[model samples]
Target chain A: MKTYIAKRLLGAIPTLIFISMIVFVVIQLPPGDIVTSPLDRMQSQGVELSSEAIQNLRAQYNLDQPLPLQYLSWITNFVTGDMGYSYLFNRPVNELVGERIGYTLLITLSALLFTWAVAIPAGVYSAVRQYSLGDYALTTVMLVGLATPSFLLALIVMYFGYEWFGISIGGLFSPEYRDAPWSLARAGDFLSHLWIPMVVVGLGGTASTMRILRANLLDELNKPYVITARAKGVKPLKLLVKYPLRIAINPFISTIGFLLPTLISGEAIVSIVLNLPTTGPALVQALINQDMYLAGSFLMLLTILTIVGMLISDLLLAWADPRIRYE
Target chain B: MSELKSQDAIESDNILQVRNLAVEFHTETGRTKALQGVSFDVPRGQVTAIIGESGSGKSVTASAIMRLIQPPGRVTAGSIDFAPSGSEPYDVLALVDKDSRLEQLRGDHISMVFQEPMTALAPVYTVGNQVAEAILCHREVSKKVAWDEAANMLQRVGIDDLQRRMQQYPFEFSGGMRQRVVIAMALVCQPDLLICDEPTTALDVTIQAEILTLIRQLKGELNNSVLFITHDIGVVAQLADHVVVMQGGRVLEAGTVRQVLKQPMHPYSKGLMAAIPGLAPKGQRLATVASVVGATDITTAYPLTRLADGRQISLSPSQLKAFGHE
Candidate 1:
């Protein structure tokens, strides 16, 4: 098992390197350089730097170099822990990400947890009671959840939240606790305000998971083994959970490979509406202004997370099912 | 003619009695009567084999005994009276609303081995766990005791290396070995009535022989009555003391194995006998089942094709003499 995991991790290095190249090219795809974009924003703010100084800034940031050479330098520096500057925020790219990373990680994890908790049981119920009134009701609700725009939902929720309860409808904490240091009270306040974004983001994912699980489980329930188990006199509930369910959950587990990486920058628009200080907005801003190192680093992290998530889920699947063989 | 019967005549000394059992399948096309007034009996501590071709209600009879028939197919009429050892006879069909009572009987007092033995064992669970689960489901025993019995059952089924083999998954075992595991699972609870639903049909000849021998040995040791469901007349001959032959959801003839095989009364039963390959003479074309039975409107699919020369496809007198037919 250790050897299999080691081989998997080793294999992932090349995959991440390939993804980094794609992330670099794609981040650079939009027309406009870091210097020109920041220069345009600065002019809009009624503060302008001369064109010579602009050219000087490009030279300083190595924007004057060829793309390949620049990528090479950026990658080397990144490997050595020197994530470059972001002219958009006038701060170090690493610092900008660092400030919001904690909140982003917390919310995304919570949202994912909520999604699985709600979706798996709902799917099982829907499948077991397929075509029943309850199944149809759940199907309609899931369709609505999937089709609704999350940003619009977030806006409506935020408006109702403030109007109804006088609770602060945006951000991770109340005004006084926003800048507070680590404390149980502050943690409690954070949680109190955390659920809004979690729900708004998790709702669509919950619907998607329900659909996948319901379909997979329905297919599994019809297999001969289910009948065999039933004939063994296994009770209805235990039979459903143990025999077919164990196999049905494989597809859902494989989804974990793609799910974790998306968490880093998912819900960008929803986060914007809720005014949550998360890296979702930062990654979007970095891509827009061509903040190459910041955007590349975030994208690289997403790629690494994808590789890591796939490895973890593969190991989990192997553990859950003895049929899977790494060798 | 001595086996002339209705529901009540089948009750005495029988471990299982199915009386006018009717199952209908309701689908979008329409309701089709799958089992029409099907009645049979399994005598105590003996193998009573139900033989029929596909869709002849052979499997439905097994399912009805265990009450495992699913939706769209329901037993609309019947009283399956099960007189399990040490218990009074009760209507098996009446336990439909009493799932707890049925659960107590199924896999505990009555267990079954299905045709697809590889698919019968749950893929993810260990062979030992799958077997032990049957014991634990109906008995109030510790995990260790249940597993010990499970291992013993496997040993009785002739599987060697109990410890390591118990830990292995279904895919790790061969088809014959898997069937043994399936049998071990069914018998671990020491059920009063064992249902074999074409258990050897999926196996190759040598493996099938091995499985048949194993079942005979195990059934004698446990002293359990078996409702052996199969289409193979050869298999019925090997194991059954009595036999019931069915066609088109109705019983054509049922009596002792000697009476049914040697003196088959119905045209369908006679056709089934003639269809067995080795009984026909060499260098003479064997009659297709449709021609042998004089295929009825309901059984048209049995006709392989029509031959212009009926005399060319006739069975020889010597083979007919061996089969105890005129």
Candidate 2:
């Protein structure tokens, strides 16, 4: 198993390099350099922008260096865990990126847990009561969840939050609670506003999982082994859970790789709609300003997350099924 | 005539009676006949083997008795009157639409052993848990008692280190051992009738013999009726008291193993007998029976004369002189 994991990690080097190159080239080809717009805007306002001032700004930000040298410096600093400085925010890119990683992880992890908790039982019940009213009702709800876009759902949820609770529909914390220490009161304030984005992202994802799990369970139910269980006179519910669900859920678990990307992308849209201070909006702003350091750091982090999610899925698959051998 | 009467009397003495049983499958193309009008009786304490080739509907016949046929297939016609001697005979076909009645009969009175041992047993579950499941399904027993009974059943089926083996999954066992586990599960409830469908086909010959012998021993010990299905005549010869030969969804011939083996009457039966390798000489070409031959021609060809009263009078080639056929 160690050898297998080592091999997999070794194989990932080229992949990471490829992702880095794509991110670097795409970010460079854009319309303006980081300081061009702000400098031009300041000059157009009748503020005298001298060549000495512009060159000083360029030298301070490393914009005066050649493109290859800038890329190499970025890579060297990145490998050493120094993400350099943010040109747009005028701070260390690491500090800026680190501040939001916690919030994103909280939302993503909570949504994943919520999705499985609801979707698995729903899928099992739907399969057991197939073609019954319960099955029909669950299926219809799943279809609705699938067809509705998460962003649209997020907006509707925000509107409902404003109308029903009389609470502010945007931002992660209340005005008075902002900048306060982490306590139950602040946490409660955070959670009250957290539900909308969570549901908006989670429910959309749960719908697909429910459908996949239901189909997998239905397929397992038809296998001869299930018939053998029934023939053994096993009670209907026990047989459904023990034989059908246990074997069927493996495929759904392996799909975690595909699901993580959805969660990341969906969180971005949710964070934007709800005005939560997360990496998504920050990454977007960085790209628009051509802040190479902040943008590259965020892209690399996303790439690492995608790779980790896939690895977890593979390990989970091996654990869930005894027939699978890493060697 | 006396044999028929005795067979009828044995029906009252037996556990399950299947009379004129037929099953058909409704396909997208049309309703394909799976089992034609077939009739046989499983005696109280003996094995009755139903031997046939693939697609000859032997499995369908067993599935029909259990009333487990799925959509696109059903018990289209005929009756499966299961008379557990001294009790009222319940019509299996009548229970086709009544799930409660079928559920009541299944696992409690009629249990089945499927063909593929590996696929027949749930892969995720331990062998003992699966066995205990059968006992718990019919009886309102506690987990401890059910598990104990399952362990006992495993021992009865000749599994050593029963406690250890019980905890292992189906994949951990060899092909022969898996079949034994399956048999233990089926017989754990000690149902009156055990339906085995090609139970030994997936096993190697040595293991096949062991499984067949184990089944025979278990049937003897339990004194239960077995409806054994197989295409191997050799297996049928080893296990059956009576043999029913089937082909193309029809019963071509049925009689005592001695009668079927020594003197097969139907053309299909003759073909099957002739096709048994090593039974005939290597150089000599065995006579192949024609396709259109029927039961009426069988009587004349074999010269097993039937009396006016419908008694089958056996006449050998040398005994033909007595009937003045020579």
Candidate 3:
């Protein structure tokens, strides 16, 4: 098992390197470098600059070098934990991401837990009572949850939240705690406003997960093994849970491969719309401004997390099912 | 004929008694009767095989006995009386509303082995866990005791390498080995009555004989009654002491293995016996029930043969003679 995990981690190195190259290339694909917009603003302001001054400006941002040399410098700096600078925020990329990483994880992890807690039981109930009034009711509600656009739902919820509940739904904290240092009241304020984005992002995942689980459980409930378990005098609920549910929940474990990266990346559109301080909004801004270091770092981190998540899910699946484990 | 006893012999000699049992499936199309007034008795300490082709209600009868018919299909009418040893005799149908009681009776006193051994065992759990779960469900033993018992049961069912095999999953084993594991699970609780619903139907011919022999040996050693359901007459002949021949959800003939297989009084039963490929002379075409009975739908073609006059009626002596029962 140790060797297997080591091999998986080793195999991920090449993928991470490949993705790093792609992130660099894609960032460079934009027509203008980060210097273009600032230079354009200066020229529009009617400031006269000689060719020598422009050369110095390009050298300051390391844009005057060969592409490969610039790539090597940026990559070496990135590897050594110096993630270069972000032209968009005009701050070091590390400090910018450091400020937002905690909030990003907090919301995503809680939303994931919420999704599982709600969806798994609802799915089991729906499948066990299939076609009953409760099943139909749950199915309709979850389908609506699945079909509606999340950002739209976030907007609607925000409107109603402010209108009826007198609670401001945007951002994760009140104005008083927005820039405040960590304290009980600030933490409390942060949590009080966290659910809006959590629900908006997690509802869709919960709906799809519930539906998948229902289908998987329904298929397994009729399998001959389930009948064998039932004939063994296992109580209906216990038998359902122990035998088929064990198999049905496998895909849910594998979904962790996607979920782990979201812990860092957050939900891009929802975070932007809600104005949450998360890496997603930061990455989007960096891409728009062509801030290669910040954007490339974000992409690289996401790639690493994805590989780790897939490995974790594979290990978990193997642990849960011996067939996969021994194979 | 000598096995015939009075109705008062219910709890004394028989382990299961089904009376006027009816099951129907209510679907969007219509309600289709799966079992229509089916009645039979499974004598204690012996194998009683229910024989019929597909849709003959052989499996339905087994499910009804275990009260395992799922939704859209329900036992519309039936009284399945179970007289398991060391338990109070009760009508199995009456326990439908009493879930815990029914569950207690199901795996503890009466267990069922299904067809398709390939799918009969849970895939994710280890063989030992599944077999031990069966014991744990009913008995108050610790996990260690249950595991030990499970290992012993596996050994008895002809599975070797107790140490490694117990830790392995169902997918790791062959179909025959998996069937043995399933049998070990069914017998771990030491059930009074074991219902095998075509347990060997999914196995190859050689494996089928091996499984049949294993079941026979286990029944003798364990001293439990078996209600075997199969479509193969050869399987019935090899394992069953008493036989119930069914067609179209109804019983056509039921008696001792010899009485039913040798001198079948009903045209349908005779046709079924004659349909056995091995029973036909070499190079001769195999006769089917439809052809021999001269009816496309034999279920409706013949009324059920009355067992009261079964002693006097004998038809198709040539088929019986071909069967080497003359």
| Number of colliding residue pairs in each model | 0, 0, 0
DockQ of all candidate complexes: 0.60, 0.46, 0.77
| Residue-level lDDT tens digits of model 2 in A1-327 | 676667667877888888887878788898778888888899899898789999998898788988878888888889899987887898999999899978887787778888888899999889777878998999899889889988898888878878998877787789978899999999999998776677777888887788888899989987988877776656667777888899999887688888878887899888988888888889888988888889999988888888878878877787677666423
Off by over 4 Å in 1: A38-54, A261-265, B1-10, B297-326
lDDT of each: 0.80, 0.79, 0.82
| Recovery fraction of native interface contacts for candidate 3 | 0.89
Task: Tell me the deviation in Å of residue B177 in model 2.
Answer: 3.3
By summed lDDT, the worst window of 10 consecutive residues in model 1 chain B runs over B304-313
Best by lDDT: 3
Clash-forming residue pairs, model 1:
none
Residue runs of model 2 more than 4 Å from their true location after superposition: A1-26, A29-32, A43-56, A63-82, A117-144, A159-168, A173-186, A325-327, B1-10, B76-108, B136-167, B250-252, B284-326
**In candidate 1, what are the lDDT values of residues A51-130, reduced to their tens digit?**
78988998998878898998898888888888888777888878887887777778877988888998999999999988
Report the Cα RMSD per candidate. Answer: 5.8, 5.6, 3.9
**Candidate 2, B28: how far from true, in Å?**
2.6
Better of 1 and 2 by lDDT: 1
lDDT string for model 1 (B1-326, tens) is 02223346336588887777889999999999898777667889999999988988899888878888888788899788888777777888887555676996788888889899778777888988888888878888999998999999889888899899999888989999999998988888888899999999899999999999988998989899998999888889989998888777876567789877887655677788888888888888886667786756234222111123110111234433454544
Instruction: State the displacement of the C-alpha of residue A197, model 2, in Å, after optimal TM-score superposition.
Output: 1.6
Q: Compute the DockQ of candidate 3.
A: 0.77
